[model samples]
Target: MKVLIAMDSFKGSLSSKQGSEAIAAGIKEVYPSADTKMLPLADGGEGTVEALVEATKGTLFTVPVIGPLQEKIEATYGVLGDHRTVVIEVAAACGLPLIREEQRNPLIATTFGVGELINDAIERGYRDFIIGLGGSATNDGGVGMLQALGFQFQDRHGKEIELGGQSLKDIRRIDAENVSPALSEAQFNVACDVTNPLYGETGAAYIFGPQKGATPEMVEELDQGLRNFARIASEDLGKDIQNPPGAGAAGGLGAAFIGFLQGELKSGIELILESVKMEEQIKGVDIVVTGEGKLDGQTSMGKTASGVAQLAKKMGVPAIALAGSITEEAADLNEIGITSYFSILTKPMTLNEAIDPDTARQNLQVTTAQLFRLIKAFKQ
Candidate 1:
């Protein structure tokens, strides 16, 4: 029998590759001679580069860039399949993790490092780019990113605007003439999960700013900032960028790329699955296993497991999802071809203890073994 193991990072616990391996281990125990394929998955977010690196034979490059608060950090991106495609995770330098609990402040955060990473790739003659936009710590609507790519944002008084989301309120002039001409020569795909528009009640600021350390006033301010930027982009750049689906991602960085860079916004799961040729590998596989760190209402929304199940349904394959925790809404997944769901935690345990990932992995392996035995019995 053949089996495919695909999974997303068990965030704070195990990586996507590790999760897939554990699932494969369990199935192989039941059919020791089974053919197993492991594919690590990410939704164009935090573990994107790592997932792609683990799945594809690829090399990673590190470049020095400015962090969220202007600190120096070495952000890494990947060259996949003979360096023809570049994979980048925006969170490496400017993500929320770079900011401490005490220092979380969307008003002052920036995405400059993300731009620098792209610029570095451009300099290396990479014209095809895959950008995963997740785990951002800013609400600057990509102004910080634009700045790094040679676009200037100036106040009405003709002064250069200062950095951070707070500065967007200053009446502004946008200058894009010096912007990297190389961008036009390249193709960019943004891996994103959210479908929120650029501005409104469901927009970037109101929905995501709070987690990035924004207060009520800051969310209001940042939302206005994104709207203002979109106004200019529509009028000056001839692009109607605001309110585009997924434009609220990465704190309005989605709008920034969609407007300024003309990047393509695509679901992270779709892009990753296509890039890795996951569908081709799943053909004729007896069973497929996919999982993530958590399963909840949000999991159905362009998540790794959801993507896999959708594909499995298309291929007429039975699939199972394993997670650290399975929420009530996960039941909807069964309709998409996920046969069942499993939670790795065996007993009531603390988050840390439940996430004692090695134990959880072993449990998943054992569970799969039993599940396979049941399948064999039924077939007999």
Candidate 2:
């Protein structure tokens, strides 16, 4: 029998590759002659660079860049096996975790490091880009990033505006004349999962600003700043970018990508799956196994497991999910493509015990063995 195992990371316990290997070990215990293929999976978020790099045997590069609050920091990016595509996660540069709780102020944060990473990759001759837009620490309408890339946002006095959200209202001109010339030859496929617009009630500032340490008053100021930036961009750049589905993602970085770079925003899961060419990897597999740290209603909403199961279903393959924990809402996953779902725990334990890497590995192997044992018996 042939099995394809593709599992997302189990959070702090196991990585996607390790989780798939554990499942493969279990299947081997049941049928020593079985063939299994392991594929690591992620949904274009925290683990995206690691997952894609591992899956494609890519190389990782680290560079020094400016952080959200003008501090210097080290950031990492990846080059896929193809050698032409570069993957960058916004979180690496200016994520919320980079700052202390008391210092989380969106108005003063910046995404300048993100543009620096992209510029570095371009210098290396990489023209294809897959950018993950998650866990940002800014609401500057991407002005900082644009500035780093040589897109000048100038005040009425013809001087470049200062960086960060607080400076958005001072912009009276947008200039791309000095942009990195190589940028025009590049293509960006942005991984964005949210649909918030650039500025209003459901937009970047009103919805995500508070989470970045904005008070009620700060949120209002940031929203107005975004509105001003959008209007100026429309008049100067000839693009109305504030109303797109994902324009608010990564605190208006999404708008910058769309308006200036001509990037396409897509579902995170969909983008990652396409990047990995998952359908080609699953062909002729007898059964597919996929899961994550947890399975719940949210798992059905374009997460890694749901994305895998949906593809397997379209190819006439049965998909089984194995997770660390399963909630009542996980039952809804059955309607999507999961033939069945199983929790890897065998007995009650503390959260710490459950997440122990060795313990989780053993449970995954044992559970997989038992399930395959039944399948073998029925086949006979």
Candidate 3:
């Protein structure tokens, strides 16, 4: 029998790759001759660069860039060995973790570091870019990124606007004359899973600003700032991206990608699946084992587990899930064509106890051993 193990990181516990290895060890204990394949997956949030590089053996490039706060920070992005594709995660540059807990302020953060990475890759002669829009610490509507790309946002008097989200309130004229000339021949692809619009009730400010250390009043002000930005962009570019899906992602960096960078937004999971050649890998496999940190209603929403199960079902392969803990309300997964499910632990445990990856891996070994035994006897 052939089994494919594709799982995301088990939260703080094992990485998807480590979890796959643990699963393979357990499976081998029962079926010594079974063929097992591991494909660790990432969802464009955190860990995207590591997953992509590990899977494709890509080369990593490090550079010093301006962080969200215009502070100097060392950032990393990836270049596939194929030489034409450059992979980047915005988190690596100006991510929330780059700032202290007390320093978290969306209105003050920026995506300028992200643009720096893009510019670096462009200078290296790469024409295709895959950027992950997650873990931002800013809400500048990609203004900093625009600044880096040479789309100067000048005040009515022609002075350039200041950095970060707060300055978005400055009314502006946009000048693209200094923008990168190679953009005409390049392609930008944004891999993300959010569906929020650029501004308003479901927009970036109202939904995510709080987590970035905003007070209720700040949320309102940030929302207004984003709205004003939308108006200016529409008037200047003659385009409406106010409600574009994923535009709220990475603090409106999604809109920047669409408007200034001309990038296509794609679901993070779908992009990973395609990146790993999962469609062909799942074919003829007896079982497709996929998982994540938790399984719940959200897991049904194009998550890695759901994406894997749906594709496996299409190819007539049975799919199963193995999660660190089965967050309640996971019943929806049954409706998504997952043939069965498994939680790593057999006994109840606290969230921390259950996810301490070493404990989880040991529990996984025992649980998977039993699962394979049951399947083995049933088949016999």
Best by lDDT: 2
Estimate, for each residue in 177-228, the C-alpha lDDT of model 1 and write its tens digit.
Answer: 8877788888889898788998889999999999999999989998888888
The weakest ten consecutive residues by lDDT in model 3 span: 48-57
- Per-model TM-score, in order, reads 0.94, 0.96, 0.95
> On residues 1-380, what C-alpha lDDT tens digit does candidate 2 reach at each position?
99999889999999998998999999999899999988888998888999999998999999999999989999999999888899999999989989999999998999999999999999989999999998999999888988998999999899998878999989999999999789999999999989999999999999999999999999999999999999999998789879888999989999999998999999999999998899998899999999999999899998999999999999999999999999999999998999999999999999999999999999999999999999999999
Candidate 2 lowest-lDDT run of ten:
236-245
Error of 1 at 133 (Å): 1.6
Model 3 residue 110 CA deviation (Å) reads: 0.8
Given candidate 1, what's the lDDT at residue 88? 86
In terms of lDDT, model 3 sits at 0.85
lDDT score, candidate 1, position 133 = 88
Residue 125 CA error for candidate 1 (Å)?
A: 1.0
Q: In candidate 1, where is summed lDDT lowest over 10 consecutive residues?
A: 234-243
